[model samples]
Target: MSENNKIAKELVEAVGGKENIASVAHCATRLRIMVVDKDKIDQPKVESVDKVKGAFYNSGQYQVIFGTGTVNRIYEEVTKLGLESSTKDELKKEAGKSGNWFQRAIRTFGDVFVPIIPALVATGLFMGVRGLVMQEQILGLFGLSPADISDNFLLFTEILTDTAFIFLPALVAWSTFRVFGGNPIIGLVLGLMLVSPALPNAWAVAGGDVTPIMFMGFIPVVGYQGSVLPAFIAGIVGAKLEKWIRKRVPEALDLILTPFLTLLIMSTLALFVIGPIFHSLEEVILNVTVSVLSWPLGLSGLLIGALNQVIVVTGVHHVFNLLEIQLLERFGNNPYNAIITCSVAAQGGAALAVGLKTKSKKLKALALPSSFSAFLGITEPAIFGVNLRYMKPFIMGLIGGGAGGFLASIFGLKASGMAITVIPGTLLFLNGQILLYILVNLVAIAVAFVLTWMFGYSDKQLEQTNEA
Candidate 1:
């Protein structure tokens, strides 16, 4: 058999043969399998299989990390073995049946927020570039002052940088509705209403430049530009309300009355009830997050950085999306991104150390490429493939992350965006913080590399793992 075919066969046996697999699917970097019985699988053998970078049980699925292109080939081979084929979305539903209530909630948040990350990343990059070009030093190099810059050009930059945040509610609501099984277009319209031109701007109200409109002479109302929680909650309510109304409305009127009643009731409740209550709660959450990140001597950063990867292992790190959104909305920068970047970079460093120190060619090949992947901001390969496989390396990485995060806190390092981190994270720091960002990541890598090289790896352990 070919090498891929061999690996695929071995993987099937390792996971208790094809009979134990309920369904199989592949994403960009991992072969995700829903297994019939977890207790029947041979976990160690699965990890030791040739060309298999790593394997782990998560979200009720046995996810085998085979790196990017390799997974597709292996997945094809696995399917050739008479396994049932499935899509990633279907696999997600299968896995979704296993997590606890909290995990499900966190996953829901992830489902909603993850789709919106690309727009935010693009907007952040635009903001960074605009800020870079508008710098006094940069302008001086062009023999021009701020006054010499064209108003139309500045207006263009504003459109690129501000549009995403100004319509952030719409994005959140649309995603939430999609996740909750409601019509996304209806959600989009509801979100737009929250930020309608007739409403007082939220930022303007905060700045005391505009007064909020009063509903019933008591409830102050303003636009939800840059708001997340209100939009998310409103989306959930509106979707459920629409479903409820749809079930009751007569078939003849279902097309018209359902949407009309849903919109009318939801709009009133969102403005008068959900918006006011949830926005206050969002502010409270934002305040608490700020307080934690602002703790004395960077203790909060140290703890967060040290534990960030640990959280990732549990598959609940998506919960951070709320904190990140809050930070960006409140301060226009994200320190959490800087701190977590250190944690991610540290994983790369530990994996790199193992790759350099290992006598096993299989491990060296896996570790080296996975480590590089970590540097580019995707850490699953490095974490599962190398660092966690060797416990000492994982702990050393945590320490390195903590050390780098301490420095990040002391320096007050913040990124202009979220979603992207590590090397690609440089874009978020382009607004005059590039040097500090590099310094923090380098420190994380160096600390993890030195510690793991000195003590984390051993040929003896590799021999044992292979023997298993």
Candidate 2:
């Protein structure tokens, strides 16, 4: 038998046979299973299975980490064992059952933001490359002046860098519509209308280069380029309106009228009503975030860095995307990314300490990769699979993150963009502050490592260390 098949068989037995599983699915690094009876599973045996880095029950599913490529193979084999499988949508429905209203709202925020993150990340990387090529030191090495770069080439680069944020409303609206069970195409149309060329550009209007259109001789309207709240509010209104219309319209006219009316009404509302109110609200949020960042003594940084990971654990952290986007739009830089990167790195450091100190083979296997994942700016593995399980390591990470963030704020560290961190994040700081970025990360890691090694793990837990 193939190794994957062999492991699949063992895993099924470990979870008390195929009958115990209601459904199963896999994401990039984990197999998520919803079991019919938790009592039937042998948790120790599951951890001991080969190729399993770690396993934990969270959000109502048993998530078993098998790394990137390995998860697909294991998932294929598990399905062949006659265990029922679920689509991602089905899995989401099952997982959604566990959280409270607040928790569910947070998960929904995560759902909306996560889909759009890849576009943002790619754009950030593109900006990094542009910044790198524009550097005077690099250009001088090639005997080139800043003017040596052609205007056409610069314009092309700007297009690549600007496309994502320029149409961010469409992406946000599409994702939100999907979440709220509306036709995503209609959502896209409504979003596009919010930024139509007929309206003055949001930035142009703000810069006084163009005047805003007066609506009903009282309200002002402009394009929602780089705006967050308008698209989000429009999406919810559109989706709920679409659902309501679908219920009342005849089945024969449902497809045409529902979509047409939804788009028509939503576009009008978004441009005149929802857009103005939420744009003002978004501005308020942006100002509040800036004021907090500017607070005395790095106090804001210390507080945000300590509490950020805790928010991440609750999955509500994606809401900060609004603030980050606004910060980048107004000031052309983001200190928030720098502050949060410290917190993410601290979690990795704490996990690494646990890996080094633990005698349990199962735990060591879990901690090492979880730590590496955390450093790469994905902390769910480290947070849920290792640090939180050991309680003390999680707290140590919080302390270390706060210290690192305080220093970062004091040094005035800032990033050119959002959504990338630690190693991949180095690209964002290549504008002459790379050394400071490295130092901040090192401080976070070292502090967390020392704290975890000193007080995070217990000798008693070590004494109880058998492989499983």
Candidate 3:
């Protein structure tokens, strides 16, 4: 009977009901989907639904965007129909349990860290281009080796990059408020108040050292600046609060009253509790990760190595990203870089191994190019076409990745930046026998190829490789 529940049902129906969908998952701005058949999907119907903006297909899934929490509702609706919300490719996973440790880890990493990627990529490319462009631009006005060019560039880069996080409270408010069904502006306003640098640096305040909040608390809407969790929480809370206020206020002036009360209550709650709690949670996650990685480098490396292959197969490799990224943010560097570097190298090796082992000219060709891609930091081809479809190569890849990851971890090597691909990915770590790490990865590939060559091959591949 509630407006929210009614809207949720209507939204689900708009997406073509239970029969039309095969599975679903969600990311920051999109709902990754699988339909019984793509043609059966009623794209027009779904798009027509309120709050539904657009939909598209990518990487073999039909994705719908209804903001943030929208995915949860649709997911709930799909489960009500008893159909799972996962891809056939991800069929190895169970339904609700898809929220397992791996899934949670991956989702957290992919969601939190992905937002920074576009800006970081832009900044890196900017720095790269500036090196080439600075002198040219400087020639227009001043002289060579212009004053503060590099310094200003670095400062600009830091400001732009840090701004994304520094103003994160408002940013989070905007996204999350939209998700939770509140007027997004309210959350944004709340975020601005909290993150505005003018506030007396409230977040760092200690128990006895200073007051929780200074003059800002005296205002009607308390600021939450730089805080993400509370703004995120407020969006949901504000939406709910707005809904309740809606019923009590006369319809004649409902809109104004709803937002006013909603923003006031949500911001108040956010300042007092939500922000601090989430910040603490982030700390806890950070501490746990550091402790585990530091406990025994060798074992951690071994675990990443052995499991990384399986995680990749399940598209669960993202599961480890949170540990990696969060630690980098909190502690300034991560030990997992070595393992990841080796894993990538192992990908190239696996593809090469599969190519060498296969007799099917088609598979060999696929494997060869895929190996090149993996070496360059792409792994889908090897994963789907060679390793997964053919079991032996996949197993060999696991053995290789596990061994390489373990070795790399023990080496205590680290990477300063995120490696997007394999080519330069090879450049990720240069400390501590980096060459030896390279050798280890190549050796894994060779062993995989030799093992698969000796024991496994389809007759087609056997004839093809033999004839070649």
Candidate 4:
């Protein structure tokens, strides 16, 4: 079995076994389960698992946090163990997530990228503002060159981003244990121990050097500072271990003894095994990014442009921010982000078209504002309220976006700086003919507007909606 599969099986048993669960599903960073008996669900028992975030019984759902990359693995493991079944009730829960394949695809993509967005955005704006400051010499930003100011900031930003990911296991443990419906305070304590520097340095052990914290080595001291994999794995281990430790210890001394042993064992496993394996996977992903973008620019841009629009809508769009700003800062002109510019045009055009076709004073008011908002790059209001609700407008917008992004890629278009207007979208496109690129963007939007009007304006639905 895959290691994740083994961990899931153990977790399933720990949480009062598989039969106790009614249903389960996962989104980006959490494993959501519905159990038949809440009483059988032991909060402290679940928190004991090193890989879990604490559990919570909110909205009648048991939510478990497993950090970023680990959720999928857990989902795969959960399915293999038969916790999630194909049934109507389950499908209904998914309805709110997304319905059509296109929408679901968008949601799935967003699920992967959303949680990391704040970190990504903070890092990008940090670099951008840092760049502007040095160029203007406002703060007299010190660096080897004007560009160096931004580069230096990114170097520091990387530390923050990398650190969060590095001890990802700890994050998962902390979150899972808290959400597990236990004493959340204890779960948070478990999380802290996984990330604490007091743990033995696993890196030293891997490198064949004796750990300075020799006592911790024999005992499994996990160091999760800015780490991802170890803490997560440890959490899974910790969860099961929690159950075993609970029955033996009396209620009076349970708090101190439970966490102390849980950390001692789980952290060791994290340092020696979980952290190392996940760290390797991260290296592989970085290498792939380097290899993929190294190919011809035109093809790269087109692919990125197409995928970018498809993924951005689901809110996972934040993941691409790294590909655009961070990748370009280092590798130059990240073509992957080029596709998003076309998406903005497509949605804005569709919204405008929807507005023009509607005569209902109320609908017209909604659609017109939606169009303007879409133009400003907030397309969800337009997508969910205006386009996807009807059907044709959404398809038309996607087609328009695809075509526009494809063309932008072919022309070697590049975006230079972040700007608000549609005209400036082309500024990033290095197409020697900047004005031509802007015109093309306008045309793409117009086409979307026309297509949406042709397909989406149904007399019956409009009349019905108007009546209501």
TM-score leader: 1
Candidate 2 lDDT over 1-468, as tens digits, reads 999999999998998788888899999989999987888888878877888876777667888888899999999999998889998778988788786888777777778888888887777777777888899999999999798999999999989888888898998899899888898988888888877888899999999999999989989999999998999989988999999999999999998899989988998899999999999999989889999999889998899888999988766787898788778767767899989999999999999999998776767888998899999988887987778867889999999899889988988988878899998898888777789998988898889989999999865665564553
**Model 4, residue 359: what's the lDDT?**
69
After superposition, candidate 4 runs with Cα above 4 Å error: 1-116, 136-173, 179-244, 286-338, 341-345, 373-378, 407-447, 450-468
Q: What is candidate 1's CA lDDT for residue 316?
A: 91
Q: Judging by lDDT against the true structure, name the best candidate.
A: 1
Give the per-residue lDDT digits (tens) of candidate 4, residues 1-468: 777877787677766789998777776556777777777876655544545543554334566656557777887788888776534336324443434566554443333234444443444344334344445344445534554456667677556435444443444566444433233344456657655666655455445674534343453333544444344345545666776787799999898888777667765555566665665564465557766654564455446544554564444454443344334433334445445677677877887887888765555665676667667656644665567656677777776776676676666554433322354444344334455567656766977887887875654666654421
For 181-296, candidate 3 gives per-residue lDDT tens digits of: 56778767877766656554544452245444532554322334344455556666766787778879999898777777777776667766666666667668777877766657
TM-score for each prediction?
0.97, 0.92, 0.61, 0.52
Question: On a 0 to 1 TM-score scale, where does candidate 4 land against the true structure?
Answer: 0.52
Worst 10 residues of 3 by lDDT: 88-97
RMSD of each: 1.4, 2.3, 11.8, 15.3
Per-model CA lDDT versus the true structure: 0.90, 0.87, 0.58, 0.57
After superposing candidate 2, which stretches have Cα over 4 Å from the reference?
1-19, 37-48, 359-362, 465-468
Cα-based lDDT at residue 396, candidate 1: 93
The superposed Cα distance between candidate 4 and the true structure at residue 137, in angstroms, equals 9.0
